[model samples]
Every structure is written in structure tokens, then in C-alpha cells.
Target: MSYPTSSSPRMWWTCTYAPGAQPFRGLIVPVLEEWSKSNVSDAFPFLAPIDHLLGSRRRISINLAKLFNFFDQEIVQRRLARTGSGSGSEKNNDVLDILLERHAMSKLTRQEIITFLTDMFIAASDTSTVTVQWAMAQLLRHPEKM
Candidate 1:
């Protein structure tokens, strides 16, 4: 939850949830699966699984791209401007703001932004969810050993 950083001010890093929170997902998922069976013929019965997979992915992508954009607009452009070439500033206070600002003064375009966001979304979401699932499964099967 908290770790030491080399930076002057020790940053209080925040994870979305605590480490033990993951195994609870495994328990809740099984309960949801059982419930889905009873409502299988209902209109939104299949939403649980589909959303569990897709929603995490989508949000992660959007957030990460926003993160990169903020840095690009804030840190990168400021450094670039010292050379009298890039003279731009972002309107907002985020990663995407910084990136969009730099892009306005540099070579990046909308197409690249979309492509990067898409790839990052797919990779970060799927890998994170699957890894959590696998770890939880293993822990459930070997609680004593763990």
C-alpha cells in the first residue's frame, strides 16, 4: 500500500484496491456465475461476465492515455520549450492535457492517440484481470500452503 520512493518527497502510492481484495473477486465471481444460470434466459443475464472483462479494460485504457497525455503536455513540452521550439501549454491538469498540448505543437495526431489508447487498453485490462483470477484460483486451492 505504501512504499519508499527515491524522490525527495516520499509519494504515497495508491493502488485501486488492497492486495487481499482480489480473492474476494474470485468468491463474488462464482456467486455471480451461479446467479446468472437462474436468469440465463433474461435480457441482461450475460452482462456480468461480459462487463467484468470489458469494463475494466476500457477504463484502464482511457485512464492511462489520459495519464500519458498529461505528462506529455506538462513535463515534455516544458522541457522542449526551453529550446525555443515547442511553445504550447495544456488547458487542463492531467496527462492527456499535457499530451494534447504537445501534439498541438509537435508531430502527434488523433490517429496515433486512438491506436495507442486501444492497444494499451487491451493489454492492461486483460492481463491484469487474468492475472488476478489466476492468483486467486491458486490461493483458493492451496490456502494452507500459502
Candidate 2:
């Protein structure tokens, strides 16, 4: 299956002021795909040793951290700039705005905002893609149902 086209816009609308660009797609899609792949260590505890030997878990963690940093730099910084500038035109009505508001009030740190935005993107994009894939598969298998 191809990558979810809607995921980029959805994540941009939800967390970034710069919706025109979708640099995060490169990082997010592959990371999520890698994460979704089943690993032998998951099925057998004894295989965990080999996972470390293969550096699989370490690679995943590093990629996740990279994804998190991308979201932080792209989304969080843009939101902070817009909110900090006190410009009405830059105002956002999305989750990022709420998180930035919290950041302004000292209720959340920069890292927390980044983490929340990353989590939101991953959860929303993955869920939407899986749901669409399942629906398409069902329709293909049972044309009469559609």
C-alpha cells in the first residue's frame, strides 16, 4: 500500500502553522511503518537478546527521537512564534494553539508540547490510515456489501 496522502495535511492542520510544507512526512511515515512491523523479540522473550545484538530497538528509538525533534522544530516553534508575536492573523484554532497557550502559562514545557504534538500526529495519522485500509479491504472482499 502507498503512504497516506491525507496524513500530511491532517498533521499540518492540527499542529503546524506552516501547512503549505510537509517535510515531516518523510520522517513520520517511515518511522511509523518501521514501528508497526512485528519483531521476533515481541513474540519470544529470548529473542530480545538478539534484538539488542541487531540494534533494532536502538534504531527504532533513535528514529522516534528524530521524529519528535522534527515535530518540535517545525510545529512547536511556529506556534510559539505566532502566539508570541500577538498577531491576530497568526492565531490558530487547533490543538497546537491550545498546547502553546499552556506553554505560555507555564503549564507545559517546550518538550512537553513537542511530545504532545508528535503523539497527536502519530495517533491520528495511523488510525486514519488503518481505518481507511480496513474499509477498502472489506469493500474489495465483499462488493455486494458496498
Candidate 3:
């Protein structure tokens, strides 16, 4: 099948679906800023309490709470959309949709589902880097298989 040059697995949604307004686009920078700073406890485990006293923990909590709230909002909105959209509506098989589908069968708790998305978001870049390195190592070791 032919594909657009600008599209890949990552951009498939945008390629096939019309663009929608992104109201949260502006709020992302501050979230990045909050996450950019390394946690003190990460470097010095014994000094964990210092983070609480110095307000580092508070900042992290506020940022995470904001992020979690956004996730919660998205979940609710998706539920409404799925319910409101009859069979005529195009089905979206995104991660949240899949998780909600499982949730419908009582397979996952809201917290567990939300954690999956958050972990994916937090580790996506790091995971990609490691994945490429691992693939390269495997390819070099198994050229015959390749």
C-alpha cells in the first residue's frame, strides 16, 4: 500500500484524521519545565526528606496532580464520546480507547490504566533510545537472521 512521505506509525492519526484544536498545547511547556529539573531524592536517597522541606516534593506533587487531572479529564471525555458516538462514528483505537475497552470488562482499575499512559509518556524518549541501541546490537549479532 502507498503511504504519504510525511506519515509514519507515530503520525498515522494525523495523516488519516482531520486536525482538531489543541487547547492544552500551551500548558505543556510548563509541565516540561517542572519535569526537566532532576529530583533531589533521585541523586541522594538519604536526603529525601530535604525535598519535602525544600518544597521540591510539593512542586512535583502539584505538577503530577495537574498531569493526572488532565488524564482524568481525557478519560471522562472519551467515555462520553464513545457513548454519544453511535456505530456511524469512526472508531478510534488509541491507547486510551483500548484501555477503556478493557476497563469495560472490569479488567483494569482507573489508576492502573492511568499509570500505564503516564509511564509511557514519561519513558517514551528513553525507551526509544534504548530500543534503537538494543536493535542495533541484535542486528550486529545476528546478521544471518537479518
Best by lDDT: 2
- What is each predicted model's overall lDDT from 0 to 1? 0.43, 0.72, 0.60
- List, residue by residue over 1-146, the lDDT tens digit for candidate 1: 11111221111112223454543233223322333243322458557576555455455445555545532343444445434554433133444444455567776775565455335433443455557779999999999968
Give the distance in Å from residue 64's predicted Cα in candidate 2 to where it truly belongs: 1.4
Q: Which pairs of residues clash in candidate 2, taking residues 3 or more apart in a chain or in different chains?
A: none
Candidate 3 per-residue C-alpha lDDT over 1-146 given as tens digits, one digit per residue, 9 for 90 to 100: 11122222132121222345432332333445555567788899998898778886677677667767766777777777777867524447766777888898899988887777656555542455557779999999999978
Sort all candidates by TM-score, best to worst: 2, 3, 1
Candidate 2's TM-score:
0.70
What are the runs in model 1 whose C-alpha is more than 4 Å off? 1-90
Task: Please report the candidate that would top TM-score against the real structure.
Answer: 2
Number of the candidate with higher TM-score, 1 or 3 = 3
Candidate 2 lDDT by residue in tens digits, 1-146? 44664455453455443666667776777777777877888999888888788877887788888887776676656666676887734755666667676877999998887777677767866787789889999999999997
lDDT of 2 at 52: 86
Instruction: Name the lDDT value of residue 115 in candidate 1.
Output: 52
Ranked by lDDT from best down, the candidates are 2, 3, 1
Q: Least lDDT summed over 10 consecutive residues: which range in candidate 3?
A: 1-10
TM-score of each: 0.33, 0.70, 0.61
The 10-residue segment with the lowest total lDDT in model 1: 1-10
